[model samples]
Target: MSSISSRDRRHLTNGVKEHLRELSVQLALLNHRVSAGAGLKQVDLDCLDLITRHGPIGPSALARRAGLHPATMTGILDRLQKGGWIVRERDPEAADRRAVTLRAVKERMGEIYRLFGGMNAAMDELCEEYTPEELEVIAGFLRRTTDAGQEVTADLV
Candidate 1:
């Protein structure tokens, strides 16, 4: 195999950074459109997604994960509850009666899923072009990128 020169490596690194930045912006725009179509704010929709993926989760924990203030999370949760998108349940097993967990209204998730169906399908089609090893590498890269983003966000927050 031919070794990459330092200059070529730097070029490839810059290209990857640019593409990742573009991908982030495009994803945000897509989420904004999907949120609009679903009649929900983008942040609210994002919180709902978090709830769906990590349900039986406490409000405080969810707030941390979403990088939202507790007050902001309260409003979002209220709206979601009012819209029938989520349910807040008191932890019966806990000593504190006020400890509440958030859960997504699974039946009401169809609309959100339908909104994202096109993008999901496209992603699946794209994945079809890659072999298992290539897919694994892609997945690993994405995972590391996400972790890095979260780390930076945590520092800022």
Candidate 2:
């Protein structure tokens, strides 16, 4: 929107697009490695990640987030529960007390952490190159990209 040349803007946009694709592929590879390490399918691993991020939520809410059928969520939950990666709990004192919520098992998180710790450590090292002001700009860029992705997904739904 500034007075930047159109060719320069196009080059910058293409760079961002390629970086996003590379990030997606890297994440998929990481997912595969971690899931296999934990004896889980990739989708189940992704479902567990969603629960870790958005829990403690109900199964229906989880399915909605994962774009899966309610029945499909049940099986995924069952597997995770059997593996002791998550639990379904209910609050007795709350209204609608019979409703269940999903949460990750804290103890089992070590496996996930171990699988991801190397990448996280590398990212931490990379952050050291940037000043706080630079980081703020980087964070804003990441947040905008995430918001843009969510907006697109919402539009499709």
Using lDDT, give the best candidate's number: 1
Worst 10 residues of 2 by lDDT: 91-100
Give per-model TM-scores. Answer: 0.96, 0.91
Tens digit per residue, CA lDDT, model 2, 1-157: 4889999999999998999999999999988998998899998999999999999988989999898999999899999999999999995655897789999998998889899899999999999999999999999999999889888998996
Please give, for residues 32-76, the per-residue lDDT of candidate 1 as tens digits. Answer: 999999899989999999999989789999999898899999999
Q: What is the alpha-carbon lDDT for the whole of candidate 1?
A: 0.94
| Candidate 1 wrong stretches, greater than 4 Å | none
Query: Which portions of model 2 miss their true places by more than 4 Å?
Result: 1-3, 93-97
The residue-level lDDT of candidate 1 at 58 comes to 92
What value does the lDDT take at residue 15 in candidate 2? 95
Judge candidate 2 at residue 108 and give its lDDT. Answer: 97
Where's the lowest-lDDT run of ten residues in candidate 1?
148-157
